[model samples]
Target chain A: MSAPGQAPSAGYAAVFVHEDVPTAEVDRLEALHRPLADSVRDLVDATIRTTVEDEEVRAVRAEVDALVARLRARQLDGPAGVRYNAEGRTWSWGNAVVGERNAVAPPLEVVRDPDGLVHADTVLGAAYEGPPGMVHGGVGALLLDHVMGVAASAHQRVTLTGTLTMRYVRSTPLGPVRVEARIEREEGRKVFVVATLGDPDGVTVEADGVFIVPRWAV
Target chain B: MSAPGQAPSAGYAAVFVHEDVPTAEVDRLEALHRPLADSVRDLVDATIRTTVEDEEVRAVRAEVDALVARLRARQLDGPAGVRYNAEGRTWSWGNAVVGERNAVAPPLEVVRDPDGLVHADTVLGAAYEGPPGMVHGGVGALLLDHVMGVAASAHQRVTLTGTLTMRYVRSTPLGPVRVEARIEREEGRKVFVVATLGDPDGVTVEADGVFIVPRWAV
Candidate 1:
């Protein structure tokens, strides 16, 4: 991966890497990393709400820095770009929405039904809050975008978000939330998708998006 | 803050809290917590790229867990809702976009120009990747939504996102990015705003949004 500000050699091919790791190994890695990500997620919430004394906060920071140093003892050169194996297994452990190793990602587990609908159920915690007790509006869009991309890319075809429009029907309280998406239609390389983000009561935000298969992917 | 699954007593007032904290104390608290948040952000980036041995990873997890415990020794009952001091200083320490103590938030520092335009410059890191080596499309929307809200709420008025539409003009690589927003017009309770998310080269996503000042505020 390129350093944060240095541009990578530009192209979709460079972004999507073929590692050919076996499916078993991919699953193994997921199991190894998911628990760590979960703990980090908890740490994030604690950091936000902690009423510890100033001295304790400073002490915790020192401990966190040490752990970070230990992790950095061996590190990847850059971002964990998406990778796929020969058996058609794909893993993007660094994805901002559903990466198993991404602590910042909501704990979203997306399921694709036989009828081509993609959906996920997750708990949006304090870290995901936007307005007071409501889910952040952009966080709603982020979940919808990722799940809609899944709907568009079902059957192993890759697609990128071309455009997204969200209408806020009501405020989604930050709690148990659901996101559902399906392909509405396709025009050549552009796939139209409709999605909804909601709490248990009903839909709070509805979205429609265009996902395009890049020319290289096509 | 409400539990992860329970609904809070609903209202805009419930979300925004006035603490009457002195400005000097607010500044002192910010100085104390900002560095901790900064360190956590670095830890997140390291977590994504770490390639340590399994034993080392496990050890780091244990250490991280301990730190979390220390922080959680005392805590806020809920999310850090937006708070304002008597001096008119506002702080939303857990804001998903600009929360000073939020590790999950990108390091965005939004500024209002002399003429009322709002803008920010920040570095998007590995934790923000969507496509290979690129900024996640939803992340673009997230930054735009918050900056546009800043523009809409200039002069201390509170607003919520009513609708947001993002057009991805090009792929934004993960790195230094700029976002700019300005209010386009207003009608009664509705504020219209336009914004852009871009790399140093040029714009990648363009957005126009409707923000509503709730009836209670009006």
Candidate 2:
């Protein structure tokens, strides 16, 4: 990936190339990565909840460091920039919200419908908490922003979020939550989108966003 | 931490108790955890960026599984809910934004001042990328939400987000970014906050938020 303020690198440029990657291969890769991400997610939850003695924690840290070194012995050159194939399959495994390999991301999956609406279902666990028994306000925004951003990019056009606003009607309890987004309108390169983050009880947060098709993407 | 729709655990009731914890101990614990978090963060970035062969990847996965098993041999009963002590020290190790133990979290550190204004500086790397060379809009919102939430709760009274609106003036590029938030006004249980996410070049995103001091906290 390109460094901050730098132009895209040759590898990063490869993401925009419209090549044909067989669906089977994409499926295979995702399947492989999914389990790894799941395991890592479990690790995250375990680490946070662990209350071992200080000596035990220290020992675990040493072992974890060794394991990290082993993995880092061989690695990628840089960031996994976005990649899409001609078949309309796009994967951004490094994305903060929905990257399949991102364990830090809440277990979220977003789907867009024929009507240009986006819907998602996710569970926020202890790892995503901010308040005593509620979802972190920003975590709620994170879910809404991604789903609404997808609504603005329904056509598969490259769109960047220009601005977003959210209203938290009530505290979102940690657990199963639903997100929905639909485009309100479009003006030239700007797509206006609206969305919500809610639980089975009702809407907890509302969001409005302006997404821009940047000059470079255009 | 309480599960979805459940009342908080009895221990959570103790947060309001506020007993004195020495500053030195807080500093010591933070120092100990910081390195561990740093290593895990490196592991996360490596996992995403690795481009090794499938065979080697499988081997590494097996080793990682072993490490996870060792760590999980002993664990906590549940979530690490928010905890603070009388010295006005608060620490939420599982926080999504600033939790040192949270590898999935962006390496963000926020500081709130006596004036009820909050300031934070962080670097957005591959782990937080959203656009092509620019920070993801949701990531920007996430940072703003947390800082502004802190701004609203600057007096140490519990406040939850009520509403947030962001105007994306431009795409914030990935790299060093600054966030600032301050209370704009207040009405019965409501605190209005204004904030910005920007780079050295200029402001890239602007936000307004309403954070509510919930009835329970009140």
Candidate 3:
């Protein structure tokens, strides 16, 4: 078998495509898509809690379907791969964590500090619940993993999650939550990171992860 | 701190409410909601890949917003928590993994074997992508954690994920995937479970999880 960051296997280098789109265009696209994603997120929450009659539910479904058809009339044929322009602007609008156009992705706005710490603040609505009013453990992991990846990918280096271990200290209630991650250390191509997911009360989940820069990218 | 199976500070019992809805009515509700979720899932993919003119995209957004308002005309004040009925029927229409009406939840159909194995077959589409065509590593963990919880909760016992560790053997392509879990063992109220997420060719991720039945339930 190949070593940790060796050749002979698949890698994500291809997904990081270089497009010629200008930085201003990228920002404009993000501005346009972010609101659409917000609307979709609201739609998801409303769908979960709707108490309308069956007829009303069915009518809403029809209208949603019609809107989807309108959007599909002109669309890309596949997933939105990560793209960057010569001006150093990057976008991945289909990403499952912070994609501007992905409604299923939690609307996480991540900020990378000058010291390399990465953090985000987002509200987990009804659509993210696992237990009664708490955020699903898996969803918590998902958010942590993404934030940790962002931390590891600082300095424009591409990295993929190698291993992740999450400890659920307590339940995270559905509402405003904060996730923070920072690099603990690095060895060769692997970066070790630590993170936490917390509600207003305190920390709920602590996570440690290893991220590796693939050989091909290197 | 409370012992593993002793009096607890927080438990899921309150969420597993005993509502007196009939099983037939639950089935009817599921039938009505599942189709809407499927359509929403489709819309998510379309939104991610759409290349329509900016005007068309804004028009779709307006229509989608209208639909959301219609659904919000009458709604529950809070989340749709887990509810069970007199006939031993349970429903959690807002669950992040298996909620019938949850558009953000992946459309997973889970099954339990008589021998205590839990499995699910689902298709991961464009919206689930993290790295180009591959499933997000966190999404893999989310699926494995849910399936392992199902395995741990066999025999009508409720379990919450206490800790989860995931090893991404390889990147899973976005397509047909199968997840399977089985109880590895049990100690007191803690159930140890193992699970895998795989594409058609082979396993792409392996996971080990500890699920705890909260103290109050015991």
| lDDT top scorer | 1
Error of 1 at A120 (Å): 0.5
DockQ of each: 0.54, 0.44, 0.56
What residue runs in model 2 are displaced by over 4 Å at the alpha carbon?
A1-23, A86-88, A213-218, B1-29, B86-88, B114-116, B215-218
Docking class of 3: medium
- Given candidate 3, what's the lDDT at residue A43? 86
lDDT accuracy of residue A206 in candidate 2: 84
Candidate 1 clash total? 1
TM-score of 3: 0.93
Task: State the lDDT of candidate 2 residue by residue for B1-218, as single tens digits.
Answer: 11111222353464322436686887886677666667667666767776666776676667667656766677655555666666556667777777777676665777867766789998887777676556767788888988888788776666667778888787777789999999999999888899999999989888998887667766
DockQ of 1: 0.54
Error of 1 at A170 (Å): 1.2
Q: What is the interface RMSD of candidate 2, in Å?
A: 3.9
Give the range where candidate 3 chain A is weakest over 10 consecutive residues by summed lDDT.
A1-10
**Residue-wise C-alpha lDDT for candidate 1, range B1-218, written one tens digit per residue:** 11111122246545578787798999998888888888888888888899998888777888788888888889998888777766667777897888888888985788999898899999998999888788888888888988888888876676778889999898899999999999999999999999999999999999999988767666
lDDT of 3 at B11: 55
Which lDDT tens digits does candidate 2 get at residues A32-55?
776666766776776676655666
